[model samples]
Target: MRTARVQDLLGLLHGWYPPDQAEEWDNVGLQVGEATAAVEKLMIALDPSAAAVAAASAAGARLLVTHHPLLFKPLRRLTPDDPVGGVIWTAVRDGVAIAAAHTNLDVAADGLNRWLAARLDLLEAVPLQPAVGHLVKLAVFVPTAHAESVADALFAGGAGQIGAYDQCSFRVAGTGTFRPGPGTAPFIGEAGRREQVEEVRLETIVPQRRLPRVLEKMLKAHPYEEVAYDLVPLANELPGVGLGRIGRLAEPVALAAFAARVKAALGCSSLRLVGVPERTVAKVAVCGGSGAGLIHEARRRGAEVLVTGDVKYHEARLAEDLGIALLDAGHFATERLAVEELAERFRAGAAERGWRLDVVVFEGDRDPFVVY
Candidate 1:
């Protein structure tokens, strides 16, 4: 089996998701490593800590895929004197590659939120926010006989999608009139007399990021020299890319029982809670980290409880006043799934390339905390 290059792996990741979609300040992709390096051994961890790096080295892993970036802030220099800088130096010397998929993977369809939702057994999972940008509505006139073919081609290049449905569209049949100019060659009409043909108005939505490819595909499949089409900018919101999630439990349980179940599910030692323990809690809202900001939104949305991480003292006070049950599951606990999820993706990719990639999870990667 041939080992895959680091660049090839990066390309596969970007093909499904673009790193540019991440927050402007987020640092994703390769932190260090050779592009041409052959990757046979791999390690997955939440953070790129010294211990995690040492473990990867000991396992003979040539690549490390982490959820959080090793270098969140810009580096001043690569000198060995600096603590963080020293880690980078050691990685380069040991020939270990680093890569991260942060907010981009979090907001994508079937992304981080889906993994979280599945863990809690939330059914009918859809995007909490839809893709708003990189979207264009295409309205084109085609012959009634060929409309289906054109529509199918557009769908192949990422079009005709609204919410949960794909290949979605609206069609209306009408008479289209046009005359060919002297230099123009017409497909269905004469050069002089005005000609009318039966046409179907086919409309679908395409991503702005894929506009060029979509347009090219539409034109190639369209059977008219002058393909009449309109591109409209959409201001509609999408539930796919938004922060946090709102879902219902398999069955409503008491607030106290719900909290206990969540703690056991995440394997966390302790957390803060709001609202009466005996109240029946059904609907739940969850965000991975620092989600205290969404407390009011969750309450307004009628969620009985909001499970998140990193609640400030004042935020906890506010949550108490709101009468909404809130639980802080700790930052690392909420996001640890990201590392394991990414590892699964890498293992699948490696299998496709006929290379053996071992995705080992180090038990020592947990946060340094204890509860008495």
Candidate 2:
């Protein structure tokens, strides 16, 4: 079995949920420890609380993966005196690497919100707010013999991915004429000679964040010194990826009954519900953590009710005014579902990659709020 490093685990997590997908204000990715550090035991949790860090350390976990970032705001110092700083100090001192998926995990196609919708048995669920990525179309001209190599490099560098298919590209064969000028080290034609070479036009889509690296790999793999390529901005948003989810229940239920269902599904002791109890509900929208902002979107998407967390009193009133039911399940209740889900995914990925690492879900992490 292969030993896993912190970088290896980061790679798998980022492949599933790219950091660029995170919200602009969100802090994500590796929070502490070296990428080269070995990871024999891994722990997954919803929050990077001090207790979670302590539990992970006691359990001999070398890496701690959490949905929430350990450090959200800018810190001037790292010491045991400050709460956030203390967690950082503990992880580093205990040799435990920390990584967070954050908004990127929330917006992924198979992210937390989607998992919540599935848990509630929503059907035909789609993103209420689809994730917008900086998309670019890359067209590269490569010699026929080197087309495959160049395309492979582009794909490996995170290009040519669309929805479920990866390495997706269109290739067209053509003849290209180029003259090698003085001081030009040409791969085909000699100096002062014009040559017609069989070439292929390989075109694919790339996220702008990965464009620079992908282009670099493409250039290195191309046979010509001066690789010909065209990059164009795309206006289309990425599909099957977004922050919140909107879907339909198999059958319509009363708003009150649905609220009960939400509480049961999320294992919450109580939830605040807005709107009439007897209102019929079929369509639903859900966002995992502090999703009160999406209430308007849910109303616009024809959702009869919105299930989310951390809704202020005014937000509930706004939902009522918009003629939609709102269920405020605790933020921790809704997002905590991802802890076990992520751990299972890590376990499966490690198994497939032949890495001998144990993935554990932190059971001690829970809601900080309690009703008297």
Candidate 3:
């Protein structure tokens, strides 16, 4: 049986939800274990609690993928007596690697918020606040014969990727002139002589997060001893990624009815609502976890009701004053739906890559809260 390495899974996860999309404070990506370690079985969960670790170990899983990261803060010690330290110790002892998707998964196009909207059958859903990132236009001068090779290297290093497209670039034939200074070893001409060579100007778009690796690959692949390149910053928003989402319902429904629909879809025992039951709502906005901060934005985007978790008393009051309905559907309940979805995605990706790996959803995990 062919075993998939930790790096392979990371590639698939990051390809769909790049870590750059995560908030500044989030700790994402591989938290424990080596990327080169072989993984034969993987488990997906919402949190990295002690029970989750034990369940993964019991199932003989080599990797534990979670929505929440274990190491949120810097650790001063690694003693098993501590809470976070105990989870770390258990994972290491059981030979289980740990990874997290976190805020990046929340912001992805196929992220938790999107799933929530789809579950409620929202119409014309769009991001409440679109994600903005630095984009750079990389222009590189390459020898005519080596343009294709250099472009290939840039693409491999994570450049030229736009929505649903890869290896996208533009090239123009041009001329290049260079004088190899003393002590310089030229790839095409004598060290002390002036050289005029036919070259191509290759231009491509790259995300700022990928600039370093792309430049490294470009330099390594260019034929010239002194590679010339220009990087210009662009002011543009990244497409298909953001925090929260707003959309309309196919038909208007009472606020109480919408709350009931949310409870049923999310498998919640009960949820808090902050509006009149008879109030009618057609436009809805949703954020997966702890999204009270987006209430004002939702209202600004014309959402009559906002469905999210972790709404404070004051925030709920504010929602009522703003004349928008608010639903607090427990943080765990709102986000846990992604566990099975993530497992299925990984399973399909593994099969496509011919990796003999078992993907399992950790049903042993549960909400920490209990209603008396």
**TM per prediction:** 0.78, 0.94, 0.92
Once superposed on the true structure, which residue ranges of model 2 sit more than 4 Å away at CA? 173-179, 190-198
Per-residue CA lDDT of candidate 1, range 1-372, in tens? 877778877876665456756777888888889989987788888888777777888899887777777888988788877877777877888888888777777666656766776776665555443445656789999999999989988988888777679998899999999988887888887787698899999998876767788788889999898899999987666546656777888889998898888788777888767778899988888877667888888888878888888888889889889988888888877777777777788788778878766777755777566667
Give the C-alpha miss distance for residue 300 in model 1, angstroms.
Answer: 1.3
Position 60, candidate 2: lDDT: 94
On residues 1-372, what C-alpha lDDT tens digit does candidate 2 reach at each position? Answer: 989999999999998998888988998999988999999999999888899999999999999999989877878988898998899899989999999999999999888988999999999999999866579999999999999999999999999889879989999999999898999989887999999999999999999889989988998898898888999988787788898899999999999999989999899989988899999999999999899999889898899998999999899889878998899998989998999899999999999999999999888987889898
Candidate 2 accuracy as TM-score: 0.94
Relative to the true structure, how large is the alpha-carbon lDDT of every model?
A: 0.79, 0.92, 0.91
Give the higher-lDDT candidate: 1 or 3. Answer: 3
Q: Which stretches of candidate 1 lie over 4 Å from their true place?
A: 11-21, 34-36, 71-74, 121-134, 140-153, 161-201, 216-229, 235-241, 349-355, 370-372
lDDT score for residue 263 of model 1? 82
